[model samples]
Target: MSSLKHSHLYSYHAANSRLASFAGYDMPLWYKGISNEHMAVRTAAGLFDVSHMGRFSIKGRDANSFIDHMIPTNLVKVADGGAAYSVLCDDNAGIMDDILVYRFSSDDFIIVVNAANIDKDYGWFKQHLDGYQATMIDETQSIALLALQGPKAKAIIQSLTAEDVGNIKRFTHRRVALSGVDALISRTGYTGEDGFEIFVPDCHVSRPLQAEKVWSQILSDFATWGVLPCGLGARDTLRLEAGLCLYGQDIDGSTNPFEANLAWLVHMDKGDFVGRKALMELKDHETRKRIGISMEVGGIPRHGCEVLVKSEYVGRVTSGSFSPLLRKGIAMGYVAERYTGEGTAVEVSIRGKEWPATVKNPPFYDPKLYGWKRVA
Candidate 1:
């Protein structure tokens, strides 16, 4: 078997965690417990070492052009300090990878991609960047990223960063100082909560500013504020509960942007892109579509489980898990476009038995909490 890789924060997890091999990294699945970690973030605050996520920096005179050709988003209009959810597509409009594009300036931008798709996305960027005066840098190793998420995220994060975290609008970013450490703070996250994803230099160990400095400060400030350490397990469930899609599961090479209910990410009016022709044709009508479903049955649905409509195979669950917050199984997947609707009764086949399922409005949790909010 291949040896497991380690993140820059590996030592920290080793000190306190139930480490597991996930996406080839010896990552922490949970430290305390999934429930405890989940509750910690829901009611209080949680810190996550998301360094396993891919970070790519694209810079040049033609950086915008290069990205425009590669992604379906309108890259030119992305104001400095603003961000947008974007996805890479193939010649056929199939999703190559869904990424978060954080624009720092007109010519400088950072993309956060799934950990497993780092090499795949980097390769696609390299091959498709022809003629653009762009330089793509994979800085995954040079950065140690941390996600501070929860109800009290702002109070905890603002205590360390000089830049106003409260003023940073949703889906925007800025360079700021965190406990004297120069960092990039973005009002963004995967979990459905108010949070900041801070980026720190990996090589800088001296706490004139360091990871520990920011960590300790955030912890101390949030002690009464209710902040704790969360792991990948809680992260997964939280995102799932928020009705977010995972790269390999809910979306992949076979899933087109239109079919994945990600049409908002596709900008057909943006002149032309990699899969413009194919995507434009399907823009008016898509045969299959993605939807969120919450199970009312006793059994929990899992990924790859068969989905049935009237006892006939219709689709399969892509991302599924028991939501601790909701006390039921929730999932997202693709099905015949005709079957995508609220209250559409369905069935999920798990193990050897079939269980009842139904389509529900996404974000099993409160929708208002999913967006950014000011601390009261």
Candidate 2:
């Protein structure tokens, strides 16, 4: 709305991408084109400048206590160099922001949050830190993140660092040097395809030139692998195809982890947490379910479209798009619990008409042919 904040690679993006204002930051929507970038990530590889997301460093004597108090997951089991997808919840167990927690040790950790929730999440984090001996530093500006995703993601990083890229298993991270600058490489991505999220941080007070160098080197060195610089448009499509939830759309302030079908991330037996009491009550009391649907015989469903069954309103579409990979309209939305069963008949209202659709568990693209599980 006002002057937009810029990432370190803003200049590069300005020259190469079609820029748009997203989350109060000037970000790329497409480079060559949405379809071109989307297909590249599904087949070969795609690089994304995700520096707009919030990055935080948490460290101190009570770091574990502070974090474990906020999340329902048992942080005790998260080994050093391990990471897990978790959420920040309100007292009522309502979703505030879904986040990724990376554990380096008992007292050192990294938390990555969505771009739009930076200030809100940070303020909440500080309030919760009052009793704990730890400190939370907002490193969103200091760190530059590049998500190199697709089948060939590992090979590109392997060529840069001496570390065994294969050893960094999924949900694990390691310190590696690339383009002569140190970085933290994590084997996690939004795309269902196997890939890595590389974090490049500035050493001195000045802005990080190393971040730009690393970004350049990956594109120049791996031209043969067909690595294209992607934008948020492709990122959204790939994540939806992977069946992953976007914070604001798929899950929001009113959504709980269980209702969003993220029960696996909640550790009820892990002892007390901020929302543990409320979540325990919500466990089996869920009246709504987050369902993925596919449209074979209608126009592309958009957010806010009404979901119906037999002409009765059931819910609304949260995130929807024409799947670039599956070649059909796919979406994720919440509905009355009874209507969420797999293969259940549903219809989405677009404009004034209802389009025939069905509730299907996502990775809307077939797993046997696409995704990390499929043989490349």
Candidate 3:
């Protein structure tokens, strides 16, 4: 394989992490350790270098109209400076990628997408822009993204800026100065925690130096706040415990929002959007549903493990891990609709042996114990 592209934080990760190739980027798999980083984000704060995710700016007279027809969610419902989580879909309602749309105005917005799908998503956007007057600019390489997450996230971030981060509210954003860098701070995260995702622009100019400077400043400022530098390994386990879907693992080209238990993102009533017709048709005919499962026996479940119902193969695990917070194996997978109810019994094949498991509605961790609710 060819050498992987490196993020602006490559130097820092190289010095501190066990590196691995992911989505064409050389990313950190772990720093101190997965379990250690996971708990740090759960109890205190953790900083994640998520600059690899694709970032785009869409602006034009017809931006809102074009965006409304592209995703399932109602863009009109999102006020200025607010964010909405939605998915891009093919004509058949199959998910292309889940994305977060940040509305700066009716004619201006920013989209953050999974790194692996950047080119594909950019193509999709261009293909459908034939009649729209919007201009989509790929800003992926021009910015560095960092996620400051956990219970102490707000406190740490607030100390750096005069802006009241406490008033940001969830799913909202503001342009502010962090230390000395101008940044767009959003009250959003994937770890189901009260946190902020900071976007620092002009990263491509100075290369790694600009990114490294900001990253170092944050860590140094909060050195005593128990903020650990996290990696993708902990990110996976944390998101799993929160029951959040991973792009390729939990939801992908073959999965639709309905089957993935993300029907809430679809605004059926908001007339006319790509995949609306197909999604409407599949709404009542979903054969399988995504559900959470927790192991009763001690064993870690992995992706592609068979899920059994009464000794019959019912489904396969899409994402699983040994949840550090729960002290047991937890997973999310698609199973027959009949077996999706909470308290349903099932068995997961772990290394050719069946382990007792039970189905439950996600998130596996209680919102009150962790996530946005915990900090709110």
Measured by lDDT, the strongest candidate is: 3
Clashing pairs in 3: 192-371
Whole-model Cα lDDT of every candidate shown, in order? 0.83, 0.90, 0.91
Q: What is the TM-score of each candidate against the true structure?
A: 0.94, 0.97, 0.98
Kindly list the per-residue Cα lDDT of model 1 for residues 141-186, writing each as its tens digit.
7877889988878887777756668888778888888888888888
The runs of at least 3 residues in candidate 3 whose Cα sits more than 4 Å from the true structure, single-residue gaps closed, are none
Candidate 2 stretches with Cα past 4 Å from truth are 203-206
Instruction: Write the residue-wise lDDT of candidate 3 on 1-376 in tens digits.
Output: 7588888798899899999899999999999999999999998899999989999999999999999999999887799999999999999999999999999999999999999999999999999998998999998889889999999999988988998888899999999988878889999998978899999887872485666776898788786878899999999998898889999999998999999999999989999999999999999789999999999987899999999998899999999999989899999999999999899999999998999999977778887878778635
lDDT of 3: 0.91
Which digits, one per residue and each the tens of the lDDT, describe model 2 over residues 1-376?
4599887788889899999999999999999998889999988999999999999999999988899888888887789999988998899999999999999998999999999999999999998888789999999888888899998898888989887889999999999987678999999999898899999877321475888888899888887789999999999999998889999999988999999999888999988888898898899999998999999686899999999999999999999999888788999999999999999999999899889999999878778777788766
For candidate 2, what is the lDDT? Answer: 0.90
Where is the poorest 10-residue window by lDDT in model 1?
A: 201-210
